[model samples]
Target: MAPPVVPEAIARDYNEGAFVLDRSPRASAALARRCLEQVLEGYLSATGSDLKKQIDSVKEKVPENVYRGLHGLRTIGNFSVHLNKDTNTGQIVDVEPEEAEWTLEVLDLLFDFLFVAPARAQERIDGVNSKLKASGKPLIE
Candidate 1:
């Protein structure tokens, strides 16, 4: 099932990222990072130019696991673009299969924290309220 997103653009990039994971981990990482940034900045109101700083603004706002995991993903996605690497072998730096899988896992964690668990919890709360109303009992506030 498609993960719930605040906007369609985020969903588009995220799904497209997952789609290209096997063929190109770099693109997958890029799109995943882009989607992450959008969710943080656009939805959560994180402020900053780069993902690192954007992440920084909201680090205290999210759970500890989300904060820790974001850094790992940023490293993987920004390696080729941001980090300084050895130029001796002239080898291209790209994301590995494990890294791509890990990024997806991180995305899952973030989505579950931000959207899924809350939605499910709300549904259960509403169900209880409905039962309470039918029984003429006090509803949970």
Candidate 2:
């Protein structure tokens, strides 16, 4: 079984909405983190991996590209979660609107890729395969 494709139109609309909202970079980052957390929870549930163990295992099994994606989410998520502190401490020195917009876009991409797309695909694939197996049907046609 494979996950269904996410329509480009939906993706575009989602991105556009985010842009229209003009959310602060910090808010975008927080939302991205929440999305990532949902994906992680779904992955763990599907795989039946112990939460603590899975977190540790993912650190090693994730490919470089995937790790990079997660890192982006983490950075943005952390930024948003600690926005006030970061801003006050001068950790986030840039306060320009454009820069903030760019940050939001990046975070949105990260969340969509890491959480929404993959999870949905995996769920679809798994569900189809499970049904076929239960019906005593071969996976391949």
Candidate 3:
């Protein structure tokens, strides 16, 4: 089945980035970074400020695995961002395709963990609760 559309914008960015990975790794990395930022923003419920600060502030709140994934994405994407910066000579260095590919792979895992799995679990819980209510039975723990 297709994934639920919880965060549409982030999904769009991720899909577009994956689509263009081969032709433009730099672009792909940028989009993946934006996807990561959006996920962090929504997860932390803190925004409109420095992303690193927001992430740091939520260090204790986020699950260890999610935090690790976020840090990995940031580290890989930082190379893309730094290389994209214009030199004093007005030249931009592009990221290697491998870096962009890795970012996408991380995103795939994050999408399932951060969005899809929780949603599916909630759906299942709700379904069970609904059935219990209809049957005049206690809900499952």
Highest-TM-score candidate: 1
lDDT of 2 at 13: 36
The digit string of per-residue lDDT tens for model 1 on 32-130 reads 788787788777898988788888888888898988888888888786355545598666677887797677778788888888788899999999999
What 10-residue stretch in candidate 1 is worst by lDDT? 77-86
Please write out the lDDT profile of model 3 over residues 22-119, one tens digit for every residue. 99898888888888888877765755477566666666766677667667677667767775555676676567899888888877777777677888
Winning model by lDDT: 1
What's each prediction's clash count?
Answer: 0, 3, 0
Alpha-carbon local distance difference test for all models: 0.80, 0.51, 0.76
Which residue runs does candidate 1 get wrong by more than 4 Å?
Answer: 4-7, 80-84, 87-90
Q: Can you write out model 2's per-residue Cα lDDT over 24-69, one digit (the tens) per residue?
A: 6545445445544545565433233542343444655555555465
lDDT score for candidate 3 against the true structure: 0.76
Candidate 3 minimal-lDDT segment of 10 residues: 1-10
| Clash pairs, model 3 backbone | none
Query: How much lDDT does candidate 1 score?
Result: 0.80
Superposed on all Cα atoms, model 3 deviates from the true structure by an RMSD in Å of 3.9
